[model samples]
Every structure is written in C-alpha cells, then in structure tokens.
Target chain A: MNVMIEATKLTKVYQMGDEQVHALRGVSFAVQKKDFIAIMGPSGSGKSTMLHIIGCLDRPTAGELFIEGLNVQEAGGNKLAEIRNQKIGFVFQNFNLMAKATAVENVELPLIYAGIRKRERRQRALAALERVGLSDRIKHRPPELSGGQRQRVAIARAMVTEPAFILADEPTGALDTTTSGQILDLFAELNDEGNTVILITHDPTVAQRTHRIIELLDGRITRDSSRNGVGA
Target chain B: MNILETMRSALWSLQSNKLRSFLSMLGIIIGVAAVVGIVSVGLGAQSSVLDMVSALGSNLIMISPASTVARGGSVSGDAVDLFTVDLANHMQETVHNMSLVVPQVQGSGLLIYEGANLRATLVGTTPSYPEVTNYHVQTGRFLHELDVENATPVVILGSRIAENLFGQANPIGRELTYVVGDRRHSLTIIGVMESKGQVLMGNYDSQVYVPISYAMERILRTQTVSTLMAQAISAEAASTAVGDAEFLLYSRLGTTDGFNVTSQDEMLETMGDVAFTLQLMLAAIGGISLVVGGIGVMNIMLVSVSERTREIGTRKALGAKRRDLLMQFIVESLALSTSGGAIGMILGVLIAKAVSDFGGWATSIEGPALAIAFTFSALVGLVAGVYPAMQAAKLDPVLALSHE
Candidate 1:
C-alpha cells in the first residue's frame, strides 16, 4: 500500500488566555493512496484538528507527520506551503470560492500559486471544471451558482492542481440531502479515478459511503474500520 | 505567485470596491497635483525673473550713490552731486576690462506730438546707452557723440512711445515737444528702439532716451548723474571690472560710503538664491500634503487587510506563501498611488497651462519634476503598504478562516 499521509502520536495544544486547551491528544492515523476515508466525530472531538494536521495547515505540538514520505514536522513554513500546494487539495464546507472570480478563475487559483504558466493553467482549470461537470458554468461566479454547483466549482479548484490527496472538511454539511448525494457521488467518482479522498464529517450516513472510517472522541481515535479488510 | 498574477488579483479586488478605492486615492491625487502645480509655476516665476535679470545685460555693471544718511551724515548738496560725467569718464579710463561707460540721469516728462500728449520716462544717457543696456534701434540712427557734446535737441523714442505719439507714421525725423517743470523744449526724434517687453524695473518700451549733456545743460540743468553704467569686455570679467571701478571710485572720493558698485552676475546670483529658497519652501508645503495622503493610504490598507482576512486565509490554505500575500497587498496600494500620481501629473500640466493662458504667467511643466513626483508617490505607497501587508502575511490561517 502506498501511504499518502501518515500521522503518528500527533498532539496539538493551543493557548486560550491563561488556560491551555488540548485540541489533539496523541492521535495516530494513515491514509493510503486512492483510499476514500471518512473521519467522523462530534463537535470538539478534535476531528477538525486532525484534518488541519493532515492538510499541513497547522503543525502538531508533538508528533511526526509524513506526507508522501516527506516529514512535514521538519519542513519549514514555506516548505510546508509547497507541500500543501503540490500534495494536498482542500475543500471547505462554505465552498471558499472567491465571490468575484468566475468558476474557471477560482479553479486556476492553486495553479497560479504553483507558478504554472497562464495558458496551461487555464487549460488545466477547464479540464478540472469539466471533470467536476461544471464546464457549462465555467464563466459563472460563485454567487450565481446553486449550492451544489458552487461545491462542484470548489471541487474543480481543489483537483485542478493534481494533488496527491483531496482533504474535504464537511463537504456536504451545508447542502440539502438531494444536493449532498450528488456532491458525494462526484467525490466517489474522483476517488475511483485514482485520487485519494479524505472526508471529515459528523454524520454517520455521510461516513458510511466511504471505503474506510476513522472515528475520534475527545481527541483520541476510538475505531478504525475498513469495508474490505485490506489494512485495517 | 508572480508579480503579474499578484497585480491582477489586486486589481480585481480593488475593482470590486470601486468607490472605496477612488476615495482612498483622492488624497494622493490632491497631494501630487498640488506639488506638481506649485513647483512648475514656481519654476516659471523663477525663470521669468532670471530672464529679466539676464535681459538687463549680463556683462554690465552699475555704480550708484549710496545714501549718506545711512552713514549717519547730515544731508549735503555736495553729496547729491558726487556722481558726475567726469568721474564716469575717469572710471572708464582707469578700470581694467572696461568695454563701454555711459552715465545716466532719469526723470518723468510729458511728450506732445501732433496733439497726442502722454507722460513718458526720460532717460538722459550718453551714446553708449544702447551698448550698455542692450537697446537696439529699429529705425533710423541712435544718438551720436556730437549730439552729447553739442547738447543738441535730439531724442530716441521707445517702440511704445513712438506708437503712442505718431501712430502708424514714422517718428524718426519728426519733431516732438518735451515738457519738463515749467520748460517746454522741442526735440527731433532721431530713432525708434525695438520693443524690449516688460521687465522688473519697468516697461523698457515706454521710455525716451536723450543725450546726457543735453538734459544736464538744457532741460534738467543738473550736473549730477544718477547712475554710471559700464560694460565689461566679457561676462567672466564683470567681477574684475566691478572691483577696478570700486577701487577707482573710492580713491577719487576718499571714502567707500558714497557709492555702491554692483555687477549683473552678482544681482542674478542673489535673486537665484532667493528664488531657490522660495521654491524649496513651496515644495515642502506640498510635501506635507503628500505625507498626509500617504497616511490616508495606510489607513485604507489597514481597513482592507481587516476586511479581507478570510480571503487571505483562504489563499494561504490554497498554497499562497507569505511573500505572495505581501506582494498582493503592496501591489494594490502601489497601483492606487501610481494611478493617482499619473492623474495628478496631467492635472498639474493642465493647471500650468491654465495659469499661462488666463493668469498671464509664464509656466513650464518640467519633466524631471513629474518624474520625481511620480516616483515619490510610488515610494509613499510602498512605505504605507508595509505594515498592513505584514499584518496580512502574519495572520494565523486557522483563526483567520474562522473570522466572521
């Protein structure tokens, strides 16, 4: 199995006023290539912290994190940013699209940061939007699109960089049940196309569709399950 | 991200808030406009003044009687008669580098030609007046040395005086009556000088010139000359000529308090210094407004940073480096100020043109001034954008993404 992300004994402590809050306490996990996994937990369960650590958005207070065989804990800020740019794709619950930019422009954002040339960036963005079934709405701004369509545009933006893994935080949390199903179908399709997908959600119905599940409670993993007993 | 990408993003963001961007740019616009306009007009005035000084004859020097009262001496008639044609001649013979020497006396008189009466400034000077004062005869001939020795009733009319008195007719060879206090002397117009335009001293085209001997012996009946005008052989020799004249005058008069000698170059230098100081003071005042405009830019950038905190976080999460965010905001502010500077430069040129057209002032728009002002506005933008950009760059991504 090719491990795309591996977090070992990760702990994160944040200072709140004069008190210390442990957001994560000695959590360990690994995500394999092309694996569709859902991290499930209720609020304050440190699921978000786990997602952040996996996305390379925040450093752990004590742990070793490896992204594609590169130790993220030893990476500098800029190096970590490069890792995020080249390896991890992030999808927020709110879509996080620039409201003023068209769908294609938003899709091209990561490629711009990746220092790709303009013509190639546009070509790849169009391909990504086509992949997300947003080819017809490529010129539309986020505000002009429906919630599901907006999430599709966000997905296009995420996958446009051809990153190793797509890290989605509550991808369908803000959508209606019908729209949520369609977005989940798109994610499954993307995962089937050989892109690793990590979905963070509190809803079991949302987690049940994935191939594997990692459940957290009070900053510790309680269950790690695989539908096909490959590496569970 | 590359600079071009950053600039595009910055421009897109600014376009989303058009009114706010323009309002923020207004301060810089006014500041740069004021600076460009004031400096250009001030330079015009300085150049005009310098032109008038140069028109006075670059190689010329003047010797005049100093006020005896300034030396704590009682008024004496002998002191008023100290400067004479004999002393002028003696200085001409003794001073090195002397080219031409002309003594002059000045008064106001009424002229009558064919019932057209006008008051004109009368300059009683020797034949060398044309060479010493740079006056050229446009018609006929200038005053001859014979006219001075014989005290003949011959006079040269200025362009404006000739036009006023004789209309379209030639004034040369025409007789005109000059009225002094209780005396009316008829003089023949020997020449008409070309127009020399208005100068600091007065209108050169509105004066009449006569032989020094004629005015002293016949009209004013005064033996004293008001000033002794001398030309140096070259502009570079003017200082030497001044020193030699002053030495000769002091030796003959037995004291330095009675007369003052000044070269045209010295007067030009003093006036140039005064003009430079005035320009500096004006530019400083304009600079204050630029600083205020920079502060305004800083204030708006801070607001922009706060307003776009979530956007910054999103870009960071999408792999924008700290340097990228910094460049974006800095480029936005620079775009704002540089555009304002460009508009201000055009406005300043328009202002100078308006002044030259309507205010009757000579105004010039200097290229270097525009370049400097534009560069300064850009510098102001850079300085103003630093703190806000640093703040944006230092934002904690998680906290910023969660910000409302």
Candidate 2:
C-alpha cells in the first residue's frame, strides 16, 4: 500500500501574550492511498490545529510531516504553497468560494495558482464541475446555489488540480441532515474512485461511515479503529 | 498566479464596486485636467504676445531717454532735451548694419473734418517710418523729404481715422483741422495708411502721421524728439546695430546715463521668462491637487483591503503567494488612476478648445505636458498603493479566514 501522508510526533504551541497554549501534543498518524479516515474530537480538542498542519496551511512548532514523500517541515513559505497547490486540496465548512466568481471560475482557482495555461485550465475545471454532478450550475455563483450545491462546487474546486488527497475540515458542518447525507455520499463516491480523503468532524455517526476513525482528546490520540485492522 | 490573471481579478473586484472606484478617481481627474488646461492657456498667451511683438516690427531697435529718477539722478531739463533730429541722423550715418532711422515726436489732439470730430494721436516722423515700422500706405504717398525740408503742414490719416472722418470718401487732397490747446492749424491729408491692427504699444490704426519738421516747429513747438526708431539690415544684425548705435549716442552725448537702447529680441526674451515663471507656478498649484488626490486614493485602497480580507484569505489558501496578493491590489489602484488620467486629458483638451472658441483667448495643448501628467498620475497610483498592498499581503491566512 502507498502511504500518502506520514506524521511523527507532531506538536504545536501558540503564544497568548506571555503564556503558552499547547494545541497539539505528540500526535502521530499515517494515511494510506484511497483510505477514508475521519478525525473525531470535541471542541478544543485541537482537531482544527491538526487539520491546518496536515493541509500545509500552517507548520507545527515541533514535528516531521511528509506529503507524498516530500518533507513539509523543510519547505519554505513559497515552497509550502507550491506543495499545497500540487498535492493537497482543501474544503472548508463555509464553502470558501469567491462570492463574485461563478462555479466554473471557482473551480479554476487551483489550476490558476499552479500556472496552468488558460484553455486547459478551463477544460479541466469544466470536467471537475461535471464530475461533482454540477454540469448545469457552471455559470451560477455561490450565492445563487443551495447549501448542498455550493458544497459540491467547493469539492469540485478542491479536486480540479488532481491533488493526492482532499483535506475536508467539517465539510458538512453548515448543512442540514438531509443535505449532509448527500455530501457524505459524494465524498464516499470520490473516495471509492481511488482518492484518499481526510475528514475532520465531531459527530460519531459521521465518523462511523469512514473506513477508519482516530479520536483525539486534549491534543492526544485516544483511539484508533480500523475495521480491517490494516496500518492500525 | 500570472500578472494577467491578477489584473483580471483586480478589474473584476473594482467592477463590483463601481461607485466607489469612480469616486476615488475623481481627484486625479480634476488635478490632471487643471494642469493640462492651465499650462496650455499659458503657452497660448505667450505665443500670441510674441506674435504681437513681431507684428510691431522685426529687426528694429528703439532708443529713448530714461527717466532721471530711474537712474537715481536729479532731473535736468537739458538732459531730457538731448534727443534731436540731428542726433538721429548722425547716429544712422555713423552706425554699421543699420538700414533706416526715423525720429519721432508724439502728441494727442482733436481732428475735425466736415462735421466729424474725433480724438487721435499725432506722430511726427520721416518718409522711412512706414518701412521701419512695417506700416504701408494704402493710397497716395508718405511724407517726402521735400515736405520735411519745407516744414509743410501735411498729414497722413490712419485707416480708422480716415474712415471715421471721411466716411468712405477719398481722404487724399482733403483738409482736416488739427487743434491743440487754443491753436488750430489746417493740414492737407496727403495719404491714408493701411490697417496694422492693435499691438503691444497701442492701436496703430488710430494715429495720424506728419513730417517731423512740421510736428516740432508748428504743432508742439518743441525741438526735442521723443524717440528714435532704427532698423537693422536683417533680424540677425539687430543686436550689433543696437550696440553700435548705443556707443555712438554715448560718445555724442558724453554720457550713457540719460538714454537706454533696447532690441525687440530682448523684449521677447523678457516676456518669455515671465511666461515660463507663470507656467511653473500654475503647474505647482496643479501638483498640490495631485498629491491630495493621491491621499484620497490611499484612503480608498485601505478601505478596500479591509473589506476584502476574506477574499485574500481564500486566495492564500488556494496557494497564492504573498507577492501575488500585493500585485493584485497594486494593479487595481494603478488602473484607477491611469484611467482617470486618460479621461482628464480629454477633458482638458475640451476645456482649452472652449476657452479659445468663446472666451476669446488663445490656447495650445502641448504633448509633453500631457505625457508628464499621465506619468505622474501613474506614479501617484504606485506610491499610494504600496502601503495598502503591503497590509493586504501581510495578513495571516488563518486569522483572515476567521475574520468577519
């Protein structure tokens, strides 16, 4: 099996004026190709900090993190940005779409940052939108779309660059139960199509649907469960 | 991201807030328009003044008695009476590069012909006055040397005076009464001068010309000449002619204290300096407005950056580097000011045209002024953008994303 993400003793400390706040303490995890994993934790459990570090949006105060065999800790600011552009895709709870950009334009964001040519970038963006079952909403802006449809557009944007894995931080947090089910079904279908996915959530029901679940408490992993007992 | 993509996104954001963008650009527009319009008007006035001077006469020099007070000397009647017809003739004969010399005596009087009466300036001069001063005879002939020798009581009516007194009838061979104080003399109008229009000195078409001999002996009863008009062989030789004439006058009068010699080119140069200074002052006033406009731009850009904090965070999360965000914001401000400059240039040209058309003022738009105005506006945009762009680029993505 190919390991897409490898972490060793990741620790994060933030300064609150003169005092220090520990967000993560010696958290260790590994995700393999095509694995659907959910990081479950209550509020203040440091799950958001872990998501930020894994998505390369930030660096841990002390840790070794590797994405697709490249050391994330050794990368400079611009280099980390490049790594994120090529290897990691992010889906935020708020959809995080440019309010003014249409669905197709929003999906084209990663490709633009990757310096892809315009014609090819557009073609790939259109294909990504179609893959998310949003072929008809290509010209609609985020404000004009429903909660489920906007989340679909954001998922399409994340997948447009063909990154190694999708890092979703509470992707269904803003949706109602029915819409959240539909989004989870889409994520399941994407994962089944051979894309590794990391989902962060606090709901036990949401964690149960994934192949593996890692629960954290007070910045430390309290449980790791795998149905097949592979890499557990 | 590429620069084109950055610029495209910048333009889209500006379009989303059209009213704010246009409001920010208004300052730059007014500043550039004022600069272009005022400088053009100043240049037009300068050229017109130079044209009027050329029309007065070219390759000409004027020598006159300086006021005793100007030289910080006590006034003396003998020194004031130093200019005479003989002295003019002697200087003309002795000075090199001089083509013609005419002595002049001037006085204002009322003329009466038939029942028409009008006030007019009377000039006493020689036959060479027309040639030296660029005035030509329309009909009949100018004063002859024989007239001066005989001190004949004859005069030439200017075109306006002729029309005023004779009412289209031939003024030549007619008689008009010249009255000064209590004395009145009957003079024959031998000729009428062509219209030379108004010049820097005064209206040439409102004066009457007579022989210098008659003007001194019969009219004002004075022996002194008021001015000496000397013409050089060519425009390039006027300076040499002025120097030689000044030296001759100094030697003859035994001092250079009483009289001053000046060339037309020197007068043009002085006028040019005054025009240049006026233009610089006007441009400085315009520049102040541009600085104020730049501050307005800075203020608006800061507001825009704060308003779009979430967008910046989204782009950063999407892998946009720090420089990318900086470039986008800077490009937005640059577009605003450059477009304003373009519009201002068009407005300025229209203003110049309107002034020339209805205000009776000459206005010329110069290319360099337009270029400088545009370049300065662009520079203003760049300077104004830096601080706001830095603020936007330095935002922490996590904090920005969480911001309301």
Candidate 3:
C-alpha cells in the first residue's frame, strides 16, 4: 500500500480569551492509497480538526503533515492553493455547493481554478455529473433540487478534478436515513473505483460501512479496527 | 486576474443593479456639468472683454479737464487751464512719441434731413479725431484739414444715424440740419463711418461728428476744450507718449498736475486681472460640487459592498487576490464617473452654443476646461472607491463562507 497522507504529532490549540481550547493533541495518523476510512468520534472530539489538517485546509500548530510526499506547512500561499485545487477535494456536512451556479457550473469550479478552457471544463463537468447519476439536473440550481440530489451534485464537484483524496466531513450528517443510505452506497461505489475516501462522522452504523474505523474520544484515537472484505 | 476579465465581471455586476448604478453616477454627472458650464461662462466673459478692448485703438489715451475748487470764481492760470487748444498744440509739437491729437466738445440735439428727424449726439472734433480714435470713414470722404481750415459746414454721420436719416440711399452730399443750444445750422454730409459695436459703456457709432472750430463757434459758444485725445506711434509707446504730453502741457501751461490720463492697456490689464480672479473663484465653486459628488459615490459604494458581501466571500474562496477585489470596485467607480463626465461635457457644449445663438453673445467652450473636468471626475471616482475596496478586501473567508 502507498501511504498517501502521513502526519506526526499533529496538535492544534485555539485561544478563547485567556483560556486555550485544544482542538487536537499530538495525534498521529497515516492513510494509504484507495483506502476507505471513517473517523468516529463523540461531540467536541478532534475528528473535524484532524480531517481539516489532512485536507490541507489548515496548518498544524505543532506538527508536520505530508500529503503525497510534499510538506504542506512549508508550501507558500500559491503552492497551498494549488495543492487544494489539484490534489484534494472537500465535501462539507451542509453540501457546500455554490447555490448561485447551476449543477454543471458548480461541478466546473475546480477545473476553472485549474485554468481549463470553458468548453473542456463544461464537457468534463457534464461527464462527472453523469457519473454521479445527475445527468438530468445539469441546468438546475441547488434550490430546485432535493437533499440527496444536492449531495450528489456536491460529490460530482469533489470528483471533477480527479483528485488523489476526497475529504468528506460528515457527508451524510444532514440527510435522512434513506438518503444517507443512498449516499453511503455512492461513497462505497466511489471507494471501489480506486479513490481514497475519508468520512468523518459520529454514527456507528455509518462507520461500519467503511473498510476501517478509527474511534476518537477527548481529542485522542482510542480504537482502530479493520473490517477487511466483511461488507464485500 | 486579467483586467479584461475583471472589467467584464464588474460590468456584469453593475448591470444587475441598474437603478443603483445610475444613482451612484449622478453625483459625477452634476459635478462635471457644473465645472464645464461655469468655465464656459467665464471664458465667454473674458473673450467679450478682449473684443471690446481691442475694438478701441490700442495706442489711444484720453485726458479730461480738472475740477475747480471754487464754483463762484475761476483762478487766473491755475483753474480751468488743464485742457485747451494751446495745450493740444504744445503737446503735439513737443511730445516726440505723439502721432496725432484732437480736442473734442460734445452736446445732444435733433438731426433733421429732408422730412426725416432723429435725436442724436453732436460731437465737435478736429480733422485728426478719426485718426486719434479707431473710428474712420467707410464711404465718400472724411472731413479733411482744409475743411476744418475754412470752418466748412461739413459733417460725418455715423452708420446708424445715416441709416436712420437716408434709408439705403447714400447720405454723402446730403444736407443735415442740427439745432445745437438754440442755433440751427445746416451742414453737408461728407462721409459715413464704419460700424463700431457696443462696449461696457455704450456704442461708439451713435454720435455725429463736425469740425471742432465750427462746433465751438456755432454751437456751444465756449472757448474751453472739453477733452483732449492723444494717439501714440504704437501700442507699446502709450505710456511714453502720455508722459511726454503731460510734461509738455505742464511746461507750456505753467500749471501743476491736476489732470488724469488713461490708457487702453492700463484699463485692459485691470479688467484681465479681475477676470482671472473670477475664474479662480468659479473653479473653487465647481470643485466643491465635485467633492459633494465624491461623497455620493462613497456612500453608494459602501452600500454596494455591504450588499455583495456573500459574493465577495465566494470569490475569495475561489482564490482571488486582494488586488483583484480592489480592482473590481475601483473599476466600477471609474466607469460611473467617466460616463457621467462624457455626458456632462456634451451637455455643457450644447448649452454654450444655445446661449450664444439665442442671446447674441460670444460664448465658447475651452478645451483645457473639458479635459480638466474629465480628469477631476476620474479623481473623484478613485477617491470614492478607496473605502469600499478596503472593506471588500478585508473580508475573512472563514466567516464570510458561512454567511447566510
């Protein structure tokens, strides 16, 4: 297995007036290529902070993180932005798709940041949307779509650039049971297609669907288990 | 980001709020219009004054007699001796820079020719009067030195007076009778003068001219000359001519200085100075209007920033630089002001032309003023855009991204 993400002694502390809130505390983790991993935690744990660090959306206060053999903290603003644009994709809990743009335009944003021409970006975005079973909603805005369909559009946006890792921070947190089930199936399908998927959630049932689960409590990982070939 | 893309985005954004954009540009429009209109008025007045000054002969000087201290009795040689025929003769002979001199006395009477009658001013002048002033005969012949030598019953009618008495027919060789101070005398019209338009005082072509000796003997019945007219060799030598004339008069008349001599250049300089000060005052007034317009732009841009906060957040998340955001707002402001300036310039020019055509005044639009107005409006836009751009640039993506 190729190690896609490697972090050592990752710690983050935020100041709240005279008090300090420790978001992460010297947590170490490694993720391999094509791995479907779930970070399970109770409320106020460091799961989201760890996920943010892995996605390079933030810098660690007292640790070093390497994504695909590049030191993220040493990277400059343009370099960090390039890594975020070309190597990582994000899916927020609330389906953070730009509501003003149509479904295809929302998917085409990463490609635009990559400086792709308009025609090619549209073609590639349409194909990505089709792969996510959203071909008929190409011209519809998010306000005109259902919750599951909007989540599919967000997934399409995350996969449009063919990034190495997809960071799903509570991807199904806002969906109902049926919609969450469909989204979990979509994640399984995406993971089977040789892409690394990191799902951050607090639900045990959601964690059980992945190949491996890491449970976090009080800003530390207490249990790590692999359910290899069990769901298969 | 490229300038073209930013400009396109700004234009598209502004198009989304047509009424707001128009309202923001209104300040710049009024400011530019005020600047252009005021400058046009000032320029028209300056040019009109220049025309009037040039119409008078450049080298001419006028001298008026002194006022007597006592009205009951006149002193021997000190009183009533400032202007005289002897003084005029002495100045002409002794003043080296002088070209010609004429003594004039004036009165008003009715002019009668055939059956037509018109009220007119009667002026008594020497044969050299036309040469001393700018007036000259345009038709027939002027009253020559021989005419004045013989006290000939000859007169030169102004163009307007000729037109009033002779209706299109030549007034030359016609007889015009003037009743001056109870004496009625018939004089032959020898010449018609060219038209000299009006000035600050009055029209120069409304008076009637006759030989000085004839007028003094036949009309006023006084030997004291009313005024002395002096002409210099050139415009630059007017002061020298005046000094020489004064010296000669003082030496011949044996009197101290009690007379006043005025030159066309002196009067023009004073008028130009006053005009320049007025232009400065008007420009300051226009600048105040522009400042008020700038405040309007600033206020509108602040509103735009507040309204577009979410949009700015999205752009920042998309990796737009601070300069990119600044450029968009700045371009919006410049577009507003430049468009307003263009409309204002056109309106100002049209207004100037309309005034000139309707009021029969010489009104012109100055090129430098138009350029200045445009530049000033652009500056105002830039100043107005600064606060808004700073506010837009400082928006934090974390908070803005989650903004509802």
Positional deviation of B105 in candidate 3, in angstroms?
5.3
Taking the tens digit of each residue's C-alpha lDDT, what string does model 1 give over B264-361? 88888988999989988988887788889889989999999999888888898899999998999899999888887888888888888899899999
Ranking by DockQ: 1, 2, 3
TM-score of chain B of each: 0.93, 0.91, 0.86
Model 1, chain B only, scores a TM-score of: 0.93
Q: Please say which candidate is ahead in DockQ: 2 or 3.
A: 2
DockQ for all candidate structures vs. native: 0.75, 0.65, 0.21
Off by over 4 Å in 1: A227-231, B67-81, B180-185, B217-223, B252-258
List, in order, the clash count of every candidate structure. 0, 0, 0
- Given the true complex, what DockQ would model 2 score? 0.65
Clashing residue pairs in candidate 1 are: none
lDDT of 3 by residue, A1-232 (tens): 3888888888989889999999888888788989899999988898877866776656889888988888998986567667777777777677776666789988887776676777888999999899899999999999999999999998888888888788888889889999999999998999999989989999999998999888888777787778974321
Candidate 2 Cα outliers beyond 4 Å, as residue runs: A227-231, B68-73, B76-79, B109-119, B160-169, B177-187, B217-223, B249-258
**For every model shown, what is its TM-score relative to the native structure?**
0.94, 0.92, 0.76
Docking class of 2: medium
Angstrom error of the Cα, residue B31, model 2: value is: 1.3
Q: How good is model 1 by TM-score? A: 0.94
